[model samples]
Target: MELNTSLDVVPVVSIALMGILLFVLGANVTRHRAIRGATGNQMPTDPTDRMFIAQRAHGNAAEYVPTLIVLIVVCALLSDGWWVQALAVVAAASRYVHALGMLTSKTLAAHGPLRDLGAMGTYASGIALGVTAIAAFA
Candidate 1:
């Protein structure tokens, strides 16, 4: 199978957006930590704490974004199908939604609709991208 030499705009945009989101989340965590200087607890254990929430939001994005970006890039490289592009967009959107949910949430332990929807979208898009990549070989 021949690979598409041209750049895939959708996947590229999606990847860039995800990268930006991850960076913002990480910056938020750092900002919170810096605000709570040496005298304050550097590592907050409470889920309700703002610093803890920021840390979790950044950590969660870090965990999922890299894998999703890889899957999106692989799918785009393997195939130039619209489905791949759609999945990439959905994956990126889900990550944003998840981050918003986490940031807006009062506590991490409680279930939030945005978080649930984002998680479901993430799973669905990721699975679809993986399947599409595998099918491209056929």
Candidate 2:
């Protein structure tokens, strides 16, 4: 099968935005580590700690962002439907919301509305993207 060279702009923009968000979260973690390094706890174990929250926020984004981006890109390449674009936007937005929820929350153990919404959006969009890609073949 021939590849489509004319890629949709929506997925490209979405991917770029998500990449920026991931880097920002990563930098936040690095900043926290640097600021807290003098205390000799480079790897904080407390979920309530700000440093730990930053780490988890970045770590969580790291876990989900790449997979979502891959799915978005695959869907974009396979199909040029507007639904694919919507999925990319939702996936990226959900990740950002999740990171915001993680950073702003007092603790990681408890559920927050933003976190819950973001998780739901992420799961929904991810499944939709997968189905969209598979359906492209049918």
Candidate 3:
């Protein structure tokens, strides 16, 4: 009954975190798309413009989801411990910040580092899972 992270459901921590991000970001994208389609306004004019922040958020969500799933699955498969779980949480949180930064008209999305963070999250997690899986059973 005590909390253990080694081989028993450590992935749940990140699963819950990712789940929250998926739903929240998915809803935001849907809203942005609907607004654009209905109004044809194109929201933000540039990275530093109004409504541009949300658009950037929408973009980040679209970019990182698939790889995140792969990473999560790999970690779950390996029964990854706290580090993997922590990475998953960080990935989710980073994505959220990237998206929210998009909504502020201040260009906190950076058009550079934030995107790189997301890519690293996807690639690192995926690579960790892939390498471990191959090394274990191949």
Candidate 4:
């Protein structure tokens, strides 16, 4: 079988960047937990406000990154069109927005407009990619 090089750049770069972001967020949470004197192997039971924010941000990324990766790969395989690349770009950007919103907000549950928009954008990109995949594979 032949290999396709088209549609590879954006998704690959996005995946790498997401990995870096996850690592940084994870480290942030870990360091904060240590600062709170919870250096044991187990997670902190009572996280501070900042700890909560970091944990939630990392947790959100852990939950969504895999799905984004899968969808991006599927989109790349199905087509290397502008829509596919746009979805990849939007997915990456939304994650940053969400992370920033989580970090800057008063609480994890009370994410600001950036967080809301990021979540919506993420879902929209995933949905668009799924539809595109279906249309291409069908």
Candidate 5:
């Protein structure tokens, strides 16, 4: 495990934060749903409020696993060089950006192609890391 360096965990932990955020918020919102909730015949305490939490959990691992794997692979297999570090940073930053973009999607001003841009950033960052890994260590 020549490449099992601490740097590999940074991006992974960052991604884990995103998943945790989504899970905590999403499960909270879901539990609040009145359907088959607490009482079978009574309305929720707040009937007018619907907690709309953004589903940034990637819904499942299949969604975010690709990005996570790319980052981990690059960090572990690629040499500890500037390119690897930069790519990992991009991936980390993009995850936060994407989550931010999603949280603001309901706003009239934020509902547009820009929301997709954050995801694009993540994809582009992963692609860059893959390419760098191939170019530098393959």
Candidate 6:
């Protein structure tokens, strides 16, 4: 069966790309941990710099991507407009920026400019998207 033309593709495309990114980040963490001899029966709680950054980047994406996907899908299903597409773009960009920031930071918890901006963008976009979905359905 052919894909529905009216079904928005933005959310699918955006989330797919984010999934790839998250996979790459996870791979990087695994590779670094293995190279550094940090892997064993349990994951390293205090990993090396590269491992820590990659893990955080991947973990952060894991935390947010599902929610973003849900919001985008709901918005696309319930509404007929550009808002869903726009939010998908915002969510994707936010995750990329966040990963970049996470990888470049000296400390995962420290406020790097890109990290802060990306986090704020993610939160704002997510909130707006959730609200939009509610408005669309309600």
Query: Model 6 over residues 1-138: C-alpha lDDT tens digits?
Result: 122246667778987887888788888877877787744533545543567667778899899988887887777777767877888889889989998988888776567888988898899889999998778767
**Listing every candidate in turn, what is its Cα RMSD in Å to the true structure after a full C-alpha superposition?**
0.9, 1.3, 5.4, 2.8, 5.9, 3.7
Task: Tell me the spans in candidate 2 whose CA falls farther than 4 Å from its real position.
Answer: 1-3
lDDT of 3 at 30: 68
Better of 4 and 6 by lDDT: 4
- Candidate 2 vs candidate 5, TM-score winner: 2
TM-scores for every predicted model: 0.96, 0.94, 0.60, 0.86, 0.58, 0.85
TM-score of 6: 0.85
Candidate 5 overall lDDT versus native: 0.55
Clashes of each: 0, 0, 4, 0, 0, 0
* lDDT, candidate 1, 1-138, per-residue tens: 767767588899999999999999999988997899878987988989999999999999999999999998888888988898899999999999999998999999896999888898989998898898889867
Q: Which 10-residue window of candidate 3 scores lowest in summed lDDT?
A: 1-10
* Model 4 per-residue lDDT at 86: 84
Pick by TM-score: which candidate is best?
A: 1
Backbone steric clashes in candidate 3, count? 4
Worst 10 residues of 4 by lDDT: 39-48
lDDT of 1 at 59: 91
Among all windows of 10 consecutive residues in model 1, the one with the lowest summed lDDT is 1-10
Q: List where candidate 4 sits over 4 angstroms from the true fold.
A: 1-7, 39-48
* Highest lDDT model number: 1
Candidate 6 differs from the real structure by a C-alpha RMSD in angstroms, to one decimal, of 3.7
